[model samples]
Target: MFDPFKDFDQAGYLRNLYGEKDPQIVRGLEHTLFRTGLDEALAHVAKRRTLGYSDFLAVHRILFSAFYPSAGQDRAATVPNIAVSKGNTVFAHPLDARRAVEEGLRIGQDKAALRQHPGEVMGWFAYGHPFLDGNGRTMLIIHSELCHRAGFCIEWQRTRKTEYLAALNAEIASPGQGLLDGYLLSFVGAACERQLWGGAIDGIRGLDGRSIEDAVDGEYTDVRVMQKYQAFEMSRAMSKADRR
Candidate 1:
């Protein structure tokens, strides 16, 4: 049993980050769609879906395009063309880039049995920084998707910018998942309970990984909008955190 008001509060917090015209509406839609996407992604995970480098790139592209439409960047088209660099520099070489994605997927699967730790996954994605722009946003969505697949939720309550960035930076420097593990366990636990008790409880339960049809029902009428706002807010918040 989760507390719905808390979920709404989280949505509100994210909406503030997005600076939406109608924060409530924006938060509502973004939260909804994000949940739907999470369900779909989790289903893929449950089916043992092994995502290739290209697949990971595609997911990031879709997530960024949807969340930040004004970016005018083609992440998917650029992923294959972009090479990973070595020696701790961001986007250093192609081989490193490919290895990063591969490692991310492997780590994601390996940690599937444990509590969903989005910070670890996100740290991997951020360290990989697969794309030039929207990396943070992409990581959040990808991590959320992975969590949903693992039968858990990402609780992002009272998450400040400094803390999030520090966690990410620590991972980048050490290549360990402990920092992220702490964040996800704390954040997601709160978020799950919030969703369960919120009006979206039914919507959350009805979320099917195979499709969005279940999420589109009247019960989730406001969910799509909520998800959009939530993504926007989460991205903005994460980026702000990274800068601090």
Candidate 2:
């Protein structure tokens, strides 16, 4: 479990005290549970008046709090330099994260502008890299809401990971070019209600400078103690929630 690359932040993902390093076991244990939390976040966000930067943090927190202790916290305090897993793209520094996200929200908070230039807003969120983990999923949930509010939804299942990721890399490099927009435009379909989120989030779409498909189709090795550990984690999260 001491694998540096997968456990870059050293979050200690193993179910054993001996540190059994298996990313698949870790992912399998969390995948189904994360989807559950994502649904909860979607429902919570929908009840709000308008979306903003805070919701970005809230979504990440809700989804990953069951796994990571530092789920929703921003990286500004430590200011870690982030490297893209997909490419050599450089993300924005931690100091600039808050301002960058705020400006993006200010511009795209209007549903019309967000739909017209979703890539711009996306670029801003991607660059911020607010959470240490779950960056992609957090943005996807919030962005989906914005798109639906603007009268359309991205047909994410139709788009190929490689194609969309390449465009995303280009957008990250350029920030505001139409590369990602053009790619997504073709897959633009009617709005999808988040209420019917049965399998909407059960895809390999939580990509952010990382391999999505590989993460989803993990070789689930036997981790018999994983369930016990997960129960402990859920209790921990519930305790934290109660204190709050």
Candidate 3:
């Protein structure tokens, strides 16, 4: 069996990926060394480096800054507040981080008991908005990780935006019926296919006004790329699920 978590040397991977001379990479290395104790963070950085996927806008910045805050700051500062949205509905109430963490752990550990469906999990977290920042990216990472661990591969690359959005909307509107689970399973199936096919399938497109095709064309292509990407995603998902 392939160990997804094996040999994750975070510092080395970060330095290599961002290039040893890049200031941002240097700062990220410094921050990780100083702040987080989580053994997986560096591994995630390495995995992402292998995949060539840039961090989602805010999430990337937060990750970098956490390791390298302004001059006098002790650690990356906590985000001020988080706002969650479900289509037209939005909530600004304070999220109970501890409660969210506990629930996340429960969801991950008791996958069989919950017979967990993706939409409920997605809705629960999206609505919960546990982190002050990185909610969307974090949710995606966490959800993907659980499905992968459970023997499914969620291919965000192949997921139709309309379907993905619909599942999210359904969860926000109804919160039950398992709509998200079905959609996520389909996505997993697609991802697995893409992995087997070796880049014949187009990866995620339409993020940040760039299509997946364009993103791939603009960067390096290697078989290990998507594998690494999947690993990073799995890490995020597992981490979140364990928190609950």
Candidate 4:
């Protein structure tokens, strides 16, 4: 029972071709990957991205291709069971991941779905704990797109990580309550237009890696688990008109 959170460098930094040990070198390379990849990720957002589950995977892959081989793929696809936490907060069970994401996408399609029930929707996606790394950063883009489609956006720069994460943890721990919604709603500001996308989203903050994992079992993915996600689309029935 080796705990990865307590274990350092569980997934070795990909670009460490020479087995470099300097923390500065590792941090620099990781930031470089994020800065360069963000340019492409912003471009995808410019075209009115109504993300399906595959698009969700694509966003992670697109942003972290330079860093990890498991970038875009969900943990369920590779690892069987994972334990993810942030400092002292732990995410939901791996077994419910597929159904949780399917539910999140379904609710996020509407114009004000996020505004109305931000807690539930945000909790579901966070609970799904889809990516082994870069979940927060990738989801920020996806959440922003949903906000943009809904005719608004979060003032991410204005959000303090302390407050946002506390709220997120509360929501994930208690699914029905509106802890996250209340905290996030006050920070809702004007959407960043096309010219501003790059400046707004291009940074190291997105690469913070909020999600962490512990134990990994190989027997978690069975027929029942796979079936829950078989018909999972980006949304329930969202149209181009609805997004606008």
Q: In terms of lDDT, which candidate is stronger, 2 or 3? A: 2
Task: Give the alpha carbon lDDT tens digit for every residue of 192-224 in model 1.
Answer: 432332234323331222211101111113665
Judged by lDDT, which candidate is best? 2
Q: CA lDDT of 194 in candidate 3?
A: 18
Q: Which stretches of candidate 3 lie over 4 Å from their true place?
A: 1-87, 113-116, 131-133, 190-202, 207-244
The per-model lDDT (C-alpha) reads 0.46, 0.63, 0.41, 0.62
Candidate 3 C-alpha error for residue 152, in Å: 1.6
**What TM-score, computed on C-alpha atoms, does each candidate reach?**
0.48, 0.73, 0.46, 0.73
- Lowest-scoring 10 consecutive residues by lDDT in candidate 2? 213-222
lDDT of 1 at 139: 54
After superposing all C-alphas onto the true structure, candidate 1 shows an RMSD in angstroms of 15.4
Give candidate 4 misplaced runs (Cα > 4 Å). 1-27, 45-49, 203-244
Any residue pairs clashing in model 4, and if so which?
Answer: 52-234
Model 4, 122-180: lDDT tens digits are 77788787865567777777777777777777777777777777898777655656678
What's model 1's overall lDDT?
0.46
Instruction: List candidate 1 segments past 4 Å from native.
Output: 1-48, 63-94, 111-118, 190-244
- Candidate 3 achieves a global lDDT of 0.41
